[model samples]
Target: MPSTDFQESSSSPSSFNLSILSRRRDQVHSMDSPPLESNGQQSDLEAFQRTVAERFQDLAAAPSEELLSIPWIRKLLDTFLCVHEEFRLIVFNHKSSLAKPPMDKYITDFFERSVKALDVCNAIRDGIEQIRHWQKQLEIVLCALDNQRSIGEGQFRRAKKALIDLTIAMLDERDSNTTVSHRNRSFGRQSNSRAEPRSMANFRSLSWSVSRTWSAARQLQAISSNLAPPRGNEISATNGLNVGVFTMSYVLLFVMWALVAAIPCQDRGLPTHLFTRQFAWAAPIGSLYERIMEESKRRDRRNTCGLMREIYEIEKCVRLMNELTDCVEFPLTEERERQVKQRVQEIGKIYEAIKEGLDPLERLVREVFRRIVRSRTEGLDSIARANLQD
Candidate 1:
């Protein structure tokens, strides 16, 4: 179980960092200047902040048991999509400001971060494909042992072979030197030679799939680099739009970091420090991050392929079934038969969970990939148009 501290912090709104709010208020009162933007613009910026905070708060408040489950990850992606659309509208309303000095710099930086995220999306899709392979092995095991008239030597042999193959595949994934990405084909490409040219062109346009040596940790670090909040003067100069850009940048970094933590990807490493406490949304996001870190550090999960709860359950089921098979005798005693049946039941439950969850989860990931691509193209075009008007 994750530490109880996260649950405690998330349950109460007062647990959020209030010092930042107080400090901002003090700074405002001390300034000789008037309000930074008109009341209307200020309202829009405040609404954006509130929406981000509310969405993350709901995510943080999830029961501990559901924290890293498939459904939870889907919810996380859904939150990102909603916030991203709102951010897009914010940018559209103030598109003219995007091409001006510091604002231009911020938007450019964000677009670059989005490009890096494209690679992360590709890596995550590969991880999903790897899980599907594991599922196939699970199915084989189920076929051998499930719905049998009576347990027999031949069935045990088949189950044992499937289990061994599954173990080998998982171990290979844990070895940092080996990764699914090495053999990964792009999501945009077809295997057919006739479609190769067009598919290759589309693949290149969506960001080329990451190479064998590319590290997810390094890519995340690149996104996080120099991602500082806008200064008060810059915020004022941009009519509060700089705050929106900063918010989206932080959101982008955190979402990508969480996806890597939850999915099996090449060279996965969690950044030690990723969030600041100054933002309204930071409290909940930080708590979720800490809890996930705690999960990864657990004794049994330390070297697993991924921190996803379904993966953990699968690993557990495999270990138990393997042990039961090893010690069982032919013409099994009633007690031994009972144990085998019990373990089979457990496996059946996990198998169903994976079957129901994986497809929806993959669809959500695909949607995320498309959303990022679309958002980047539209934002860049908007900025280009704004630049032309100048």
Candidate 2:
């Protein structure tokens, strides 16, 4: 009877627990279920707040000397800060040089945009809580740079045409101001000079030179046209390859000369209204052009450093995790192992996401830089030809 009672007790224990489980199964199910949306978000927010607070405290507690003792982090900070400082100087100096109304307006606009970009850099350099804001700012700055390039090109072209027109008008005025008697005397002198064989020789030499040049040009054209035609796909693929660079650099060269023309004329006691009008027209465009170039370069550098910054942060996280590993009790437990694995996986995913986001932005900047280089190459070629002719 005692053996029977022991067997029944052992068997009844399992059934009793099973009944309890069945009775409270709904309670267990509810506990296992995901929290309500609001509760989940609130919990997440609280966790994030706690994490951010802890991060801030940790960052504050870390000695600058110790942080800087880490070679890579020091180098990263130095390079980032130095580049941004240079960018700041460039923008400020450019803004200070601005003079006329339109120029002031454009400079202000560009300066504002540049400041926004710089703000992003500063935030990243300072190790802010949120990175997404700066990422968007970087994109905004890129768009602004592109827009500045386009508008600057347009303004420069207009100013160039206007300057050309003004120069022609001035020449016409100079000609009209000359007396008919002076013209007659000049014509008479020219008629008398025409009797000389030197003039005829000179004229013949000029004609021969012209004919030679024409023949050479024709031969070059024929050679080009006779070559196998490029496929439509090939041509289309390469068509806009250097558009941004060519557009900017083309007007850039012309803008330099226009600025030169405006400067001395206004300084040499020419009518203020005459030259200042054009100077005012062009000054804004020049500032915009410089701003575009500076900002584009800044954007490129920032985009490159962005990935490095993420890596730095990830390293910090990893270092902290490594430090805590020894402190964790029961490090061989399945739960602990799972948590570590999950964390490592999360860090890896974060790294991958950062890399993926930056790759496209870097590619875009690289393409722009390539276009600029191509434009520079063409400019050099043209300069070489001009020098040869001279």
Candidate 3:
């Protein structure tokens, strides 16, 4: 079987490479023939984490320190940290899931998927290091010009060359990972591999909840289709409208449920709900049925007008994102900075509008959960009261 573990290499980059270097160093240190000290490897990881945190703080505290004040740079660092943390968690969980040493081919393929995730992190780290190094070189150039010294033409050229090289390497890494991901998807389809979870929570309880919630949501949609209004029916138009509203509300609730199921994948903090007193709850089907009844009584109600309106709003927001993507391209020119800022603001506006629609959906789901808990509490109290009377 292909090695399920990350391969240990003889050489490791000192400062520029964070993700791969750390992993490589850890592997080498742990697998020394004589098995020296393990604490050293742990300390290395700790120091690397501290360095990354310090660098982030420095940039955040004084953005003026960097030669270029680009918003995307900060975004890049933030995204890198998020992905690195997630990949780390996945690796930790994967190791814990193993029964013993000598992982099977299936597990090895899973590890390869994780390595691709780490490859992206490594590229991000390399790009950040290049930017910081260039910033330092730019400062040196400024000082040389001020003091009337030789402009250090040789060093400046080298820095520029290094930056270009790093950019190319990063792009190549991304492209390679994309190709691997496509190949894996094709292989998975051929092999009939397990489907990817809707939520990427590493824990079994949370993962199971996510899978169940997603499955239920999809099943609800399928079932609701059969409940659709009959064509050329003898039924009154108002009754048809009521049925349509009823179906629409169920569809909305299921969609909301699916999004809730996905929260653990997007935000790892949500997994605590699985272990804590909190339970996964969604908007009650009964409440939606009641809303359908009320909405059907309204005169202006026709087909799924409200649902269609929400869909239109969602599409408009999607168009805004597409425009932003089109406006922002690679090979960062001077004009790209202004475009990045403008498009970022446009994205923020679109995010807020989408949040407006989603917030109510999430709130309704939570309210349903609260009602379930409350009713359970009340039932327990009534049983206690009856026991006392007895």
Candidate 4:
């Protein structure tokens, strides 16, 4: 019954536009699910990348006035293990004492801060010691807790033994006392029957009250045994938890320090330009430093290889992402930002991969390092002497 002229044609652009919008929404939803790159691993990588990259840029863009001391909170418990952590502080900590060289990239504060006794490594040294020192302190507290629990247990045992002795004495007293009381009652009953004796009820009631008192004492003892004491096992258990804290904190730091010490690569310093130049000369991978990095990434480690691998993977991804950003002269934009975001995701993936890979590597690295360090030091010293003689 509809008029043909009034009917809107299905082929027209207006009707077709609604179909397109629905399709677009569906497309976005498909991308919205976690990426297969590692669920959200890639995203985490991208986030880390952006943070570091932005910090780098900020440092670069900072005015001479602003660049004096980095505002970043460098509370890296992990950073203390870095090969360059102590060195960088040592180099920068002396900024104020240097000859009138004003071409220094140091924010004036860096030099000013460095003047007091030149203990650039002091902070890192303190941090490392504290991590271990706190561990030892935790161990002491745990020992104290354990000792306290032992004393408490000794007290409980003593109480239980005393209760047993008291119960046995009470039972013996009751048995002998009952015999005596029974005899007396019998005599009294006989005397009462002969005299005015229908009133034995009061004595019988007193006997019942004594029996009830004995039952109550027994119940009280049972309840005391069953109820939990205020500090039973708790102190020891807390001390037990300290064992975990010690292990976790020590293991993480040990793994971190071992990584820095054993690795062939060094941080050199924050002189990115100077390093970049040296790195450029190291090999032609556009950066000589990059080539040494690739070589170092492939090094042999005993058990801790996995840990090293994980660290290296994160390091590699970071290096690559930084390199990409550096080479890109393009202006930052939404699309570029999205690309950066993708890089962050990759970094996250690398982080997880490294973590997953740490345990085996740690064991192997320690064993091998101990042997190598033991044997190589004297030989290396002799070789240096020989080279000097030559």
C-alpha RMSD of each candidate structure in angstroms: 7.3, 36.5, 27.3, 37.7
The 10-residue segment with the lowest total lDDT in model 2: 263-272
Q: How many clashing residue pairs appear in each of the predictions shown?
A: 0, 0, 0, 32
User: What is the descending TM-score order?
Assistant: 1, 3, 2, 4
Q: What is residue 308's positional error in candidate 2, in angstroms?
A: 4.1
**Tens digit of per-residue lDDT, candidate 3, span 1-390:** 112121222122233233323343445446552331244433533443434433333333332222112232333234233423432332333332222222222223333332222222222232233223323433332332223222244533443343344334322322322221222110011122233333222322332232222222223233333333223221121211222222222323322322222111211011111111010011122222223333323443221112122222323333443444355444445565454344434434433433343334333334433433443344334434544555
Error of 4 at 307 (Å): 13
> To one decimal, what is the Cα RMSD in angstroms of model 4 from the true structure?
37.7
Per-residue lDDT of 151-256 in model 1, one digit per residue for the tens?
8989889988998888777765666423323332111111222222343335334643567678787788899999987776666567678778888898988888
What is the alpha-carbon RMSD of candidate 3 to the true structure?
A: 27.3
RMSD of 1: 7.3
Task: Give the per-residue lDDT digits (tens) of candidate 4, residues 1-390.
Answer: 112222222332222222211233345347673222232332332232233223333333434322211121121222222322322232233222211222122212222222211121222222222223222322332232222312233433343343333333222222322232222210011111122122323423343223312222122122222222113132132212221112222222222322232221111111111111111011111121232233333433121111223333433444455454554433445565465556545655543443343333333333333432432333234434544555
Per-residue CA lDDT of model 2 for 114-140, tens digit only, reads: 222222222222222123323333233
TM-score of candidate 4 to 2 decimals: 0.17
Candidate 1 ranges beyond 4 A from true positions: 1-30, 177-209
Q: Is candidate 2 or candidate 3 better by TM-score?
A: 3
lDDT of 2 at 208: 26
Where does model 3 exceed 4 Å of error?
A: 1-208, 211-214, 217-334, 351-363, 376-390
Give lDDT: candidate 3, residue 223.
Answer: 30
Number of the top-ranking candidate, with lDDT as the measure = 1
